[model samples]
Target chain A: MTVGLVIVSHSAAIAGGVVELAGQMASEVTIVAAGGTDDDGIGTSFTRVGAAFESADSGDGVIVLCDLGSAVLTAETAWDFLADDARSRVRIVDAPLVEGAVTAAVAANIGGDLDAVEHAAETAWIRAEESVNSGASEAEPVVPTAIDVVTASTVLVNPSGLHARPAAEFVKLAAKFRAAVTVNGTDAKSLLRIMSLGLSVGTSVHLTAEGEDAAEAIPALVALIDSGFGE
Target chain B: MALGTDWALDWLSRTAATIAVQRSHLNTLDREIGDGDHGENLDRGFTAVLTELASFDDDAVPSDVLKRTAMKLISTVGGASGPLLGTAYLKGAAAIVDLPELDGAALVAMLTAARDGVVLRGKAMVGDATMIDAWTPAVDAAARALAEGQSEAEILDAAATAAEEGALATEPIVARKGRASYLGERAIGHRDPGAQSSALLLREAANAAIA
Candidate 1:
């Protein structure tokens, strides 16, 4: 089973809205909302958090993203109440709830383990801050070694370019093998990195891979982009 | 009179009553630097605790009362206070699990655990002008009283007195945590609402001992 996510917020609508937004990019991942009080007021609920944990976890692991201070407290309380074995697999990540949930959902959607899911959630805000500080400067691209390198380039025929949905689809496909792949000089398995490129329609998409599966991965990724992401 | 389940129930009821009476004061304090629901949230939680206390079995232990209070506060109170105070009680209960009665040393242990639980959850330091300011001194004073061979009542009295002083000390210090921290220098000169409530709860604990 893939890692699941629980979004905690003082307001029910905020939590549900975050879940909906994240779910669109990762339809295969389990994302639950644990927000508001039992009476539907604006506050975090321990019972709701407890129930969310039960529903979200599928034996692999669960990651929780919370908004505000009490939301974290409520989520932690619910976590403490879990059985010892169950508690070990649950993580309460300290990150912006919305961004963290979306990235985490995409990671789980791509068959990431618990640590990979948690890492995705944790790095959401850091990457956001880096992009803001860097302004218009592009990240330095890592050139692949000469040995075992496979590469291809194609034009983006999709009308919307590589938006969140298409980026997520691309990342999911890229994560299937052992190849270290990059699309247009960025990690191909990272949804946020792909989306940040902002490659609009008619932009050139370059695919590269370095590993045993480099040959297979490069062709598959090139074909996906060539297909217009089914747009 | 031993500090047993009866004493625990009495302490909790008295705490609920005190919170109900001081609800407005707490809210006013919270409004200065927080979301202004501290008093109402605490009142709601303690009221639920009162209901839970009423259903205890005859053979129930002291920890059971604290555990139920923790659960009620965590679920009913709709703010930071809910989880903060709820964690205090939950950890306090864990400290004294299966104990039929709380002696001076047991009370010290419970208070220490409760304070540590707040520290663990809130990650606030002593001078951060949060509940830690009141709870730390109370736990320290209780431990001191127990070491001096004080009675349970006297130990609780020491804790209550120290907590009051600590709450007052929160004034004039700028907050470094919670919503008040966002205000920076503007938060000075106002007493922490959470510290005030913590002092009030400790006072209720001491009062329960005498009763």
Candidate 2:
């Protein structure tokens, strides 16, 4: 089926970036941007969704990628409005907004099914998470740690480096403790920070965790990174 | 007198059926400016709700029945309407908490609460050309009917008309929420899919209330 890709996010710039990135990976897949506004004031809405479906030659399913809960829900409502044939060909994947959109587009370009696209999107999220976590180790802490000393490390992995999913996972793990953790490469609070790290496989970096659980947190994070961010 | 559980059950069934009947038409409108899945989505959501309703006892209270329906929609429906409509039922049930029968004022309160919940969740308003387009009008109509002390049937009829009009009114406006907003000026001529389906939902509820 012609897999149609829809990216929904709070920012059109981010969605556009994802589409551009995905296009670089896979050229043949149909990718559309929904939600948010460009400087031109273009916003993704039900009208755009209908137009995308109407214009697509491939009856392949449309995979929706949303940035947040509401976007996902809006997409779901839009999806619900489709005809039987159209609905069957529609799939909504809860992927990280920008990175997930790019990954999903690339997967779709490779003629990936819904499952494959979903996996790619998830994978992208993980990669992004690791990158963010590593960056956080470089800067001041956002999540308070239990250890007294902080160490730093780099991610050395083949292929593309830390991205969304990994960064999210890393941050999630860090949030579990009382330590203040921060990612330095970009705005630590931004989800896009990890995606911007652009870490390659096998690259080395520093690791630091300080607080009561800093010792425990450091090793656990190291283990996660060592496992290729569980990719 | 306590409203029989059958009343709620019958209402749920009728609403499902009504939504099913209008699903295709909604899809057609959505196809003009949306993903073209409104028909299938609502059909699927209501179908799931129907299945869940079938499993419930006829003796169930209105709140219980509505709550279960809300939960089922939230779980089974994958998109925005699921949460929006799900919240509607959930909030409506909460509004009428422990009430066996919903009087006119109680129904108004429940619908108003449901409308508020939808607004909070979707963050869209009447002019956004969303489901709110229909829901807002329906709520207003329902309230007016209640204020006028009309019979249940008359109030429901008014609400249904208002909803239908609201849905149709979306055709000329550019969408501001969900997927259609991306189209910018291109979205101006099309009716909003969410509003269309929402009209069907309100109409169904009105019919059920009267029946």
Candidate 3:
């Protein structure tokens, strides 16, 4: 079967970027994109998705790959309207929006069936730990050194509070380490604790690291906090 | 015109239009548990398919008509549905390629091929809170009715009813695929938008086929 691939994203830029990358990787498979404008207007996403499906023919089955939840729904709806034959041929594969689209396209170019394309897309969603660990062995080992314990004071100035975007980032970084990481001023285990602390611009936080990477970890964390959590 | 042969093109045209018309309603239903764009997206995809319908002549073969529509939908629609629906058509067309008329057995073959194509594409089963909820039962019902020497209208009716019931049954399912899957328990209590729309399309096809 001659299959086409559609990549939907929250923004046209991301979708277009994926298509461009896919073109470089595989020129044989047909790839199209449907999505909202770069600024925001998510409302227009449905229309774009429809437009994408409206453009295909009966002999071609389009595989849709979407970025987020809404995109998935939009894609599903589009699939629902297909005629029996069209619906039968159409396949929605949940692949990573950007990377998955490119990989799927390449697989399709090589005459890969729907199963192979989907498999390639799913395999792309590797565990974060696996990704980090893959390169961990390549790093030079730093000598265990002692670092001074210093309290860096900083208040979250964001209107939504520190618990919003900033805390999510902190948690992500913490997950990367093997040390016993704790967010001071509340129950560190509670996501709400660090959020409720409401660390404003002048709030003080004591960051401590006590593992092999403590020397490097503490400094990096302190720098991160000093930078206002990259706000 | 022969009973089965003449009706194939009409069936495809009507089914395409039905999907386009009800696409938005499906999107609204999906909005509750899903991203709420199922109707709108399908409408857009089918609209494009409808526009391409003029390319085929009145005398085009049934498989040729289906094949063209499948290709158009796939190339135009840009999401999971595009490929799923596209593959369905391609497989169905392939199944009935040389048949001048689609008898009850031919219909079963076509449905079976379509279902296989979907399974290969989505990797979803009957209870996945996806379109398979409607498709699986509809296919089964269609096959059973056709095997029992039922008329085209009777078979289509049974298939449509089964599809509608299947779609409604998705209300309490936790989605196993797509964005709704991320919601986990939250996805429960909401009907799958894809399944709902699939029911509508099937219902319309039944009505059109009999008319």
Q: Pick by TM-score: which candidate is best?
A: 1
Please write out the lDDT profile of model 2 over residues B1-211, one tens digit for every residue.
Answer: 2234566787778878987888888778777776676677667778978888878764567889888888677655545676788888888898988787877787778788988978877889888889999888989999999899887666667877898899889888888887688777888878887877777766766667656
Off by over 4 Å in 2: A1-231, B1-4
Best lDDT goes to which candidate? Answer: 1
- Kindly provide the TM-score of model 3 when superposed on the true structure, using C-alpha atoms: 0.56
Model 2 chain B scores worst on lDDT over the 10 consecutive residues at B1-10
Candidates by TM-score, descending order: 1, 3, 2
Better of 1 and 2 by DockQ: 1
Candidate 3 CAPRI assessment class:
incorrect
Best candidate, DockQ-wise?
1
Instruction: Order the candidate numbers by lDDT, best to worst.
Output: 1, 2, 3
Total backbone collisions, model 2: 89
Which DockQ values do the candidates obtain, in the order shown?
Answer: 0.72, 0.08, 0.15
When summed lDDT is taken over every stretch of 10 residues in candidate 3 chain A, the lowest stretch is: A185-194
Q: What are the per-residue Cα lDDT tens digits for candidate 1 across A126-195? A: 7788688876656566577767789888999999999988988888889896988888788887788888
Model 2 lDDT at residue B168: 87
